[model samples]
Target: MLLLFIPIGIMVHLAEQLGKMQDNEAPFNEIMVYLGNFSITIGNILLPIFLFLSVIFFTSKLASNTEIVAILSSGISYNRFLRPYLIGATFVAVFMFFMGMFIVPNASIGFNEFQFKYLKKGRQDRVTENIFNQLNERDFIYVSRFDPVRQIGYNFTMEHFDENNVMEYKLSAANIRWVPSDTLYRLTSYVKRSIKGEKEIVETKRRLDTIFPFQINDLTPVSYIAETKNLFELNTFIEDQKRKGASNINSYILVKYKRWSLPITAFILTLIAVAVSAQKRRGGMGVNLAFGILVAFIYIFFDRVFGTLAEQSGFSPLLAVIVPNLLFGFLAFYLLKQAKR
Candidate 1:
């Protein structure tokens, strides 16, 4: 793990430095901060890859030395020989799960902050456009555009409904700005129309102070908001975003489901490594390593393809997360069956 991790980390660090150097104004403190964040992010991303390589490398060595053959020749079942590898994989999966669920989310927060603060200075937070969603059981809201930095929205409209789904009142504003000091909203050119059975009551004001069920935070969310939240926090966030009819809700759901799915990948990869490298090959460890890399690349390709489908095309997020695992799981079983023969 250290051997692979160190070189990968150094390469990433150097790439970041080269990019920053092109700007010719890389601050020493900023670079230092980025280095710390880069290391953690790299470690988290590469942990499973390193574990897969380690299993294949060592197991191939054992097969080459006839150790596996010796054990099998003693009448011990193939399944029995796999116990230790399974146990080790289980331990690795647990550690990875904990990191993915708790530790890495916080690290991602810092890593993304550093990137936005220094690397992506001009990019704006993701502000919802054409925002139309249910504010609650009794209210629905719409806005044409929202300025995240200003905590304001333009061309805002809201509707209040009765229990029978009858429109009771409608509110319109040329602009709405959050007043943080008062914890309320100020609407400019506000207009309200109330319907009372067969009568209509209209009110107009140049400016109005009021409160709503939603807040400015709901108007603009960072792109990596899902990445920086733990499992429970992610669940709560997804629910809140869903209520707001967020277009990027699938992205958040993808992240939440992937937290559990990624850990299971360790076990699946371990099985494939053991199965593929258990037999003595004429080309030795090189052949095993090459095959392992090919399988890993394909697995990653599937994961990215399906995840993109979920994020952009409204595919099922849960299935997007599990499809790669399912494909590789079948590959593992097939390889194991051939290895036993």
Candidate 2:
């Protein structure tokens, strides 16, 4: 089922993106690489839904063949029957834990970077205009326009303040560019002003090479940066962003919480699949499969609704993740009880 669905998904995606690929003149090999990464990312996202349906299909078949009834009639308890399924779920949950924490983040980076670089025409990947940043307690930076690819900023200013909150010195440049090899910054049309005892001292230079405390990317924030980092990187990034008081800290927190919740999702989905299809109904496997699809869609919808609320408003990110699992946990418990009886 996974194999059949993957190709169909790729074909549908390729059809939708073909025009954009051609219009951008994207190379054949790079496009193929993007699609390969896309497959991994999409598969991880859809793994639970497919697993649920597959379980329902096979379990329903066992019921229809009387295999389950025969085993139960032989005095095997329902709890004993569920041992292997639960063990399988444990293995899958472990796999999901590693896949989400370590592997999928790389695929996410490649997928989103390729998307912003070539696919999103006339769209900016990072903020490039009227950007203001506080580098530290006493330092502030501004840029009129920034080019992330070139690592350059235009009309840049950095202001430094003294302990009393009075301006100590102000620096401005027509343009600033980072030199990767030399590990220095080049500033054009540079000017500096220093205030000492009400006397302003001015300095001017046509060009200057110096080091600054902040990175060039600091001028323009990447909107999808949180999705690109692996476990350790994301942890460090969240801590640093918190220190910097980032306005979108909630979004980063949401990503972190969601990654940690994937294992829990695997368990809940597996139990729900087993309980829902372990019985022979009038409609056979068709009814079980149809119900699986409905439940899978609802689970995804519930998750995304709370995720949006957490990221957009003041809702707790932890609560957003837990609520869906908690509700589904109740459903799984009720279904299992009915199946046992």
Candidate 3:
């Protein structure tokens, strides 16, 4: 696995470097940093593929050499023969689950940060443009533009409503800048209007410093914010974003659900690989390998297609993660039955 992946990874990285070097866009130091980050992130994603192929490659060799035949001839059931494969798959599954739940989030954050800073200078945080989102049960906010790098917003408005959904007060500002030193916002050209039944009282200020319920993060959420958070943090973030009426909440939810699904996929791939390679064939290990590669690519294709559908459309996130697994699991079962026969 390492033999195959390391060369491919390095070649791809070097190709990227060649392009960036010709343009003089990235420094050698940044290239090194990116190489490290890219390798780790890519490795995590590729682990299941490597494991699946490993099972097929070794198991095919065993079958070709008649080792599996010898073991099964001793009156051992195919399910019994599956015990060691299950054990190996369980080990890989647990490791992958833990990595996705904890380790990969940090790596992803760093990798994306480096990419945005050096490789993708034009990248902007995906905070909703001209956002009009619920701040709370009785409050809402609107911002025409939020500059994530500057931590500032232009044309900000906050409205507080009564239980009857009537506006109680409305605050408007030409600009709002985060005062990190004091942990408040400095609102320029601020105006507040309070509605008391039929009367309205107005207050105006050239500049006002005040604290609002919303934080800087609420204004400028990067698209990959969900990828940076661990499982617990991601759940908390999703809940908070849901409360805020975040537009990209579905994508966040998808990321959270996929952590579990991908690990389960590892197990399913193992099953399919073992089932496909367990029977000795005249075509030998090469045919089994080719078949395994085809199945692996098909699995990835289904995963990406369903995942994109869930992200772009109104499809269920849970179902997006589960559908590919279910389809391939049925394939695994059928193949295993045939192998047993």
| Top lDDT model | 2
Question: Please, what are the lDDT tens digits per residue for candidate 1 over residues 1-341?
Answer: 75667667778767865675447566777667667766766777777778898999999999999999999999999999999999999998998898888988888887887777667766765755787777778888888998877888999999999999999999999999999999999999999999999999999999999998777767667899999998889889899888877788999999988888867899899999999999999999999999989888888789889999999997999999888899889988999999999
Candidate 2 on 173-272: residue-level lDDT in tens?
Answer: 9999999999999999999999998899999999999999988986666888887788999999888777666767898999999989988888888889
Candidate topping TM-score: 3
Q: What ranking of all candidate models by TM-score puts the best one first?
A: 3, 1, 2
TM-score of each: 0.92, 0.90, 0.94
How does candidate 3 fare on TM-score?
A: 0.94
Q: Which stretches of candidate 2 lie over 4 Å from their true place?
A: 136-138, 161-167, 195-206
Measured by TM-score, how close is model 2 to the native structure? 0.90
Alpha-carbon lDDT of model 1: 0.86
lDDT of each: 0.86, 0.89, 0.86
